[model samples]
Target chain A: MLFGLLETGFVYFYWGNLLMILLGGGLIFLGIAKKMEPLLLIPIGFGIILVNLPLGGLMDYRYELTAQRSGVVQEIVIDETTRFAEGTAIVRTNAEILQSPVHGRLTSIEVQPGQNVGAGDVVAVIITTMQTDQSVIPTEPIGLLSRLFAYGIMWHILPPLIFLSLGALTNFAPMLANPRVMLLGAATQFGVYFAFFISLFFGFSFEEAASIGIIGGAEGPTTIFVTATLAPHIIGATAVACYSYMAMVPLILPPVINLLTTKKERQIYMKPKLRPVSKLEKILFPIVGAIIVILLVPSSAPLIGCFMVGNLFRECGVVDRLAETAQTSFVDILTIFITLTIGGTMAAENFITVSTLSILVIGVISFASAAAAGVLFAKFMNLFLKEKINPMIGAAGVSAVPMAARVVHVMGQKENKKNYLLMHAMGPNVAAAIGAAIAGGVFVGVLG
Target chain B: MSKEIATPMAGKVVSILVNEGDTIQEDDEILLLEAMKMETTVYATDGGKVKKINIKSGDRIEEDDIVMILE
Candidate 1:
């Protein structure tokens, strides 16, 4: 049988599937045993397990085919014997209009000459795109995950909704208090471009490189948004890397922060109470921020707009109910759907490849570099400031949110108990989320 | 004179460590608040006797919401 040809999933269960399952199990173990991002990891791991069970057809897909009108089979490929290329007239009824659905051998002609066919009949035996070989393409669409992914992910619905929930959960007061940290967040995007060029040097196409580079953002929804548009083949790998690495920010960030700073710098006390952001400022932030970003990168309107809207709900105070739902139950439901769907896409065929390995390696490089860049830039900014900001807070300038900020806060406490950087680190931590969305928009504008 | 202890941010009141009429000192743990999915201990800023509890366990409190009145 041809490789990738649909068959009993168990028959094709090879080392690839086993390996992916092990990786999924490892993710689940890390989430539970190590208490690392258990909220997202458990669902993702279970999804990987569900799809890799060799339970045939979990990821199958096909093109839709339907006859438009009822009529008699007037002729069959006029001058041909049995086969025709796509767009070639293969079925002709009275008025004559039917193109061959696929560019390969016809499995069979559904109708004979003078045979009556009904409108809305399943007369079109169209096969989906030739994934491996044209010979194995399915004649009809199959599987549930493919459709959900197509509409929810590729169609760009769920990513923005997920972003909205994230926005609702975000508290922009810290970022607005120390607006300068926005610079540190922007600096981290360097990691994206760094990995982009590195990916090209390693021979990935522009689209694929763009998708892979976004893993540096350490924001899973944004990575998914950009990847589904630019290069879908690598979404699975990039997403897995994005989330797995996000969970490991504690592991990856501390080392980079340590490598670049002196122990004295870590011990520097940062004020816990940030400048109180007024309600008006909080409300205006989402509006003005969304306008500026949408104007700059119109392509990213969906993500930025949704994010700002969610934040607006939170800041407005009038929509406490909406904000409440957006951050809580709404986010939980979306996480289940989005993460499980992501895991479903991580089929062994697509994931167990050289590209996945490259993405994982490049992801770490970009992640570490992003953290280093943040710390370094903060140190640079200190040269000009009267009251110096602790540089370790700069390491929180990734979109990992409370986790990244928490890591920085914990590290600060380790160095000096009096130092409370949670509220301060939050500035760059939240800014990094906006920074990533903005950078992702720019990339999508230029490359997508 | 009575001083009010407010939460630093919005979160669910995880547990109340001090009861009304209890004497507490500065920097004492007043209660636990869960925010951003992380639990943080809310501390007393000034030593005082708890006069009244304005919030109970499991109530969602916003930033600067008075959780307790310390006398």
Candidate 2:
């Protein structure tokens, strides 16, 4: 019997693996053909394909050692210098194992081939191997994607870097011009709590429920950050849901906005003029904003703090080189790694479950509820204010950035050609970024 | 008093939209400034005739640096 031939991955392949490969190709098609978030979708789609290939071992950790025998009383060799007594049990920490020499020096032998050791008992001791530089010299082969993910994401480094890049690219002029529009931003977070409760009703723990609720915020990095902390198992589904919804903002938000606001309200024209934000205000925004938000939600400091630092680099006008790197090169590189890891996390075994379907459905509901809440809140505010705010601008408060704001502008244009709502819509659009970050922080603070 | 049209941020002057001595209204774009891949139109704060153009296209201007003089 040729055992090696029978042990090939082809014998282990199943229908679910084929389905995941097709789904990955479909995402790639959507990214390339539909022009939807190509930067994220393409890498994630390819990662999905890479991880789903049976025997590819892209997601497996290669350094783990398993017992090869069920007996005792065999000779034990420990490197070139030492030999351990038979039946001597040995234990090593994960760090120690990873740092060991490439060939994995045997530390001891607890059982020999004929010693009749039971299952799950220690049979031998081998120190897992690594090179001094830690790049896994050719002797030991670690899964490439798994290594990147473990070091980059598991250590909690990538999400904040993404936020830093976002902050560098963002312009705060619109948000600063009309601070009150932030109320709409805050109001949009109603769906976060609403979805949290709904998720709880569906039998999710408090931590998982909080993570699911953050999908309504429509901010990808924030979603990843919260999930990575509270419910890491669901980060793949939640991040995909968040980014897909964000890309579909133009399609998803309009119907909800139209359903909630009448033509009269949508036609309410907002002046295009925005007060010029002062240099001092721009410089103070990140500093003061970080202090206030962090003081309120310390758990959010990592994401918010990095964001403010990047923004300060931009607005300070002294660090143009640093800001440029953060916005362009740094962001682009980190995005590729993060999206790839997010995709890799969705192995067929983990992704095709009923829980993923439930997450997808709940995510859409959360998004719709968020859009509705924003429009309804704007209408509520109009009753008190002498100057009526166009309710459509409220729909921009979901933190999809320019897309949500652009949708509002387009809807306003449909009602009145003379209406220019882009600038006014931007006020809430930028505020939603801050609002989503704060909501994520609140969830982590309460749940974590 | 001649009002100096100052740019609010440091950037390269991409284009001078108005010629020297061109009559301009308050908030009328005087020139386009490019920074961080974004184009910000520097607007005249006071309605006046352009008396002296202190900076031209392709000039690098600092915050509060005079790009044009309005009288």
Candidate 3:
């Protein structure tokens, strides 16, 4: 059991996360010192650093029945007759008891030589206690009630309290205005549902299905919140799967993209026509879209409401302060609580085991499938259109903001130098945001 | 192949730093432009001879619009 404590640390600790923290630190250096996407990368890197710190209990343990071993320093043997005798063994069989001392550093150095031992002046001491001391210790009847109350409060009461708070922080309203983008985003979400259904065949429950479904968004906070609400049981594994895959987006997305699309398709030319969006259209889009979505799926109202509210502020033209606050200060503050709540929810008993590994696999499939769906949909649309739309821009359907759009743009330019896909792709890019929210709403409405 | 830094933003080409066939190196300032109340410089992209000078001073340009081509 001495090395058990260290093994617990080693097993629970993620070396990949540790590496990510280092990678994040490097990104921060590149952003701040080298001026590469400073506005985004710095916070992201810091977020990576804070979230990756190992907490001993992220996943559950499967305890197996085994022969009880005596403490390393002390060995006790009993005959078969004495095995059932009263006071045969102070320690129960198969009970994990920490025989070693839990050391505490001594404070107040006043040890001259060896003065008479005082009541309170015991300097350094090793507190040796059994790990199952609570079961062994005899207490009053009230103590049982208190323990029961503590367990109830800690296990059941605290989680929902944290969940509701996180739910309050998320603003899903910005997804209202760009219906086209939202459609694409929602279209892309087929990957999540597809993965969800497939995982059920592999033996995940409905709640776990719901948890795995939201991994398509690649939004950590949203992923955590959905998993926490829908499947609090598997919150740990779900969250780990969510964050790990989200971080791996740059790595994962490119490979999936490369494998699916041919080089000729990647280089498709897109002539972007710059049509200045009217302020009236921008303002009206959110209000109309929100009403439609909220009316359709009330379960997603919280996320949709907040998202539209942000967009409303952005296009309202008069409230610069409100829009700035929503996008920056409000988002920033909420992000901290969201990340912590998400991270804290991953207690070991909730996470770990075979189910988590399956969820992670399902999440990857969902993301890849969403991307493939988006590209194929774009190609299908191109078949009917007179003015050719670059099929590569179809990839911007996933609501990853500038990253997805940039990928499309980069690929388009790779095909033809005359092609400028960024602005046109932004149309679908913004639309995908709405699409994702709608899909999220549908998921919640049907399954939540 | 030699490379030319085109107009990054909509601007008017204000002054020509090098004429046709003028030799320039990478990161060398080639010409200046006036746009959005700011003066911007077009840079030579490689260590090579300027093969062509397409625009002179006072020519209008847009974002990513080719200011010059080199070989």
* Chain A accuracy as TM-score for every candidate: 0.83, 0.83, 0.63
TM-score of each: 0.78, 0.75, 0.59
Highest lDDT scorer: 1
lDDT of 3 by residue, A241-314 (tens): 65555445455666666777777766765543344457777777668877988898886676666666666777
Q: Model 2, range B1-71, lDDT digits (tens) per residue?
A: 88887765567999999987789998677777765444556566677888989887898986678778888
Q: What TM value does model 2 have?
A: 0.75
DockQ numbers for every candidate? 0.15, 0.05, 0.06
| Tens digit per residue, CA lDDT, model 1, A207-268 | 78888788888888999998888777678888889998999998999999999999998888
lDDT of 2 at B39: 59
Q: Model 1, range B1-71, lDDT digits (tens) per residue?
A: 99988766667999999899999998788888786667777668678899999998999987778888988
Ranking by lDDT: 1, 2, 3
Q: What's the true lDDT of residue A125 in model 1?
A: 54
Task: Using TM-score as the measure, name the better of candidate 1 and candidate 3.
Answer: 1
User: Who wins the TM-score comparison?
Assistant: 1
- TM-score, A chain, model 2: 0.83
Q: Per-residue lDDT for B1-71 in model 3, tens only?
A: 65765653456888989877877776677777664333545555455777877787898876667667677
Name model 3 segments beyond 4 Å from true: A1-183, A347-350, B1-71
Q: What is the C-alpha RMSD of each candidate to the true structure, in Å?
A: 8.0, 10.0, 12.7
- Residue A12, candidate 2: C-alpha displacement in angstroms: 2.9
